[model samples]
Target: MKQREKKELDTSVQGIIIREMISHVTSEHMIGQKIKNGELRKKLVEPVWNVPDGFLLTEIKMEQFEMEWLEPESCTSDRVLLQLHGGGYVGAMRNAYRNFAVVYSELGHGMPVLSIDYRVAPENPYPAALEDAVCAYRWLLQKGYSGSQILVAGDSAGGGLVMALTMYLRDHHEELPAGLIAMSPWTDLTSSGESYQTNFEKDPLFGKTKDSLIYNREYVGLEDPKNPYISPLFGDFTDFPPMLIQVGSYEMLLSDSVEVAKKAKSQGVKVRLHVYEGMFHVFQMAMKLMPESRQAWKEAGRFISLFKDET
Candidate 1:
């Protein structure tokens, strides 16, 4: 791993420096870099470090394909939480997101977690990723799990996927999950949010740039990026499940979460928004090192525990 500069090592600037190093090593911008260098892709197979004790991992097959499943030692309830890993619709797999899911499952006292290995972009784009999620949840239901027993969750692009899946279900009148939890969700693929420009310099995850917006165009292919399925912030939130949204103050998608929350509230959907200061996109990923990451998980644990009580 390339070391970041001393000045850039400050936690406030750490996100920016990480991008600088990525750009330096891979010679590509952040948006396009994920696809070219497989930055997030290559890490997906690596086993998660620091998983809590007593959580057993198993590999389960779907249609002759396998994905990771984290089975906890005990179940606070009969529910399962399905996680969609985020890599801007182009990267990430079950292994990459296992740590958070496993920890959440463990914290919730062993609610089952089945994180998907959904198809990614450039190779599989647009509805391919969305369809895979829908299919995975449907498969789970076919296995006898009710919709109310599932809580959908993800971070960044995966966060967006959860919302999209809910919207898809609402559109088709199919069974949707009980609730959703998103971390720094990239809800507006059109990149029209003012935060995209206002937070450009401060947001190390993604700055305001037409280049970053191009990723959406590439993934969605000139389709209306504002389509409800493409941008859940632009979708109807009425009758949707309760949502817990957490976002860093400096990310370009900050407004996306805020706007989504506002809409969810307007539509009478239960919504809670937690905005952290001096944080950068999906800070929870650094749980072992970052204080904010720990706090984020703590909050997630509390929120997720509610489902068990309800059951």
Candidate 2:
């Protein structure tokens, strides 16, 4: 029955189906079994090569910032989407998220996308990741970009980073962005969501396994896991810009996404939440294989298109 469903999903959203299956079989089950395992990181760091039109693709390195850029070809000036890739906070890189950026860059609004290569945990923890995200955003501002033309985006851990970054900037009185996008963000390191328990085995992508939880513990260390920066769902959302959050119905972080959106709404922040039925985490990348993923990507592209005139 699982194989039949996999085959059906493969016909629609192949990239997600293949990766999720591999992650479940290889990284998912093996997560907590061993003391030292780089398998999850290895699998998550796979290269992404697809590039879109209307942009120049390149890499940049500064003393304080290092990242890959996707600049639209026809637009002499454009807004920026500062993206952070997710891999349980210890894995994955900006390159791994290139395809998602491409979808937004060309298909969405032809805006430039700059995906940051933030430091991972164990080697660099807590504020290190937050600092990197801030530094990258500052770099763009220094390059003459306006806050009103910028958008912060991420998936899973990166999604959490975007929310934290917004809070940090607010606390520092820095100018806020025009908008934000969080795709199945892991807003809670504490994994207190009911969905975390309910969707454990039902979801093929991830669950509250002992091993993955260990990685979360290492990332949070002694800090209160519910700290707004660690879990932005707990933060003050006043004056936040218009935002969009997409979540998978089957994901453990489903509640996190919903709570964040609900909280944002209560604070009067314009928030749009799209709960994709039968989806797992970060399902947009699998558009190459799955129709659902393709539809999700198209939806993202459409949402981003609304901002093209803002820049």
Task: Provide the RMSD of all predictions against the true structure, rounded to 1 decimal.
Answer: 5.6, 4.2
Q: Tens digits of per-residue lDDT for model 1 on 291-310?
A: 66777888888888777635
Error of 1 at 186 (Å): 1.0
Q: Tens digits of per-residue lDDT for model 2 on 1-311?
A: 69647554544345455646745564434453331233446455355665654557888885654789887777544677889887767774845488777766666456778888887776777877889999998888998888988888898889999999999999999989888899999888877878878877655555545455323566676788888888888889999988889987777789889988998999999998988776777787666576677777777777776676642
lDDT of each: 0.76, 0.75
State candidate 2's TM-score: 0.85
For model 2, the stretches where C-alpha displacement exceeds 4 angstroms are: 1-38, 42-55, 213-215
Q: Model 1: C-alpha RMSD to truth?
A: 5.6
Error of 1 at 135 (Å): 1.0
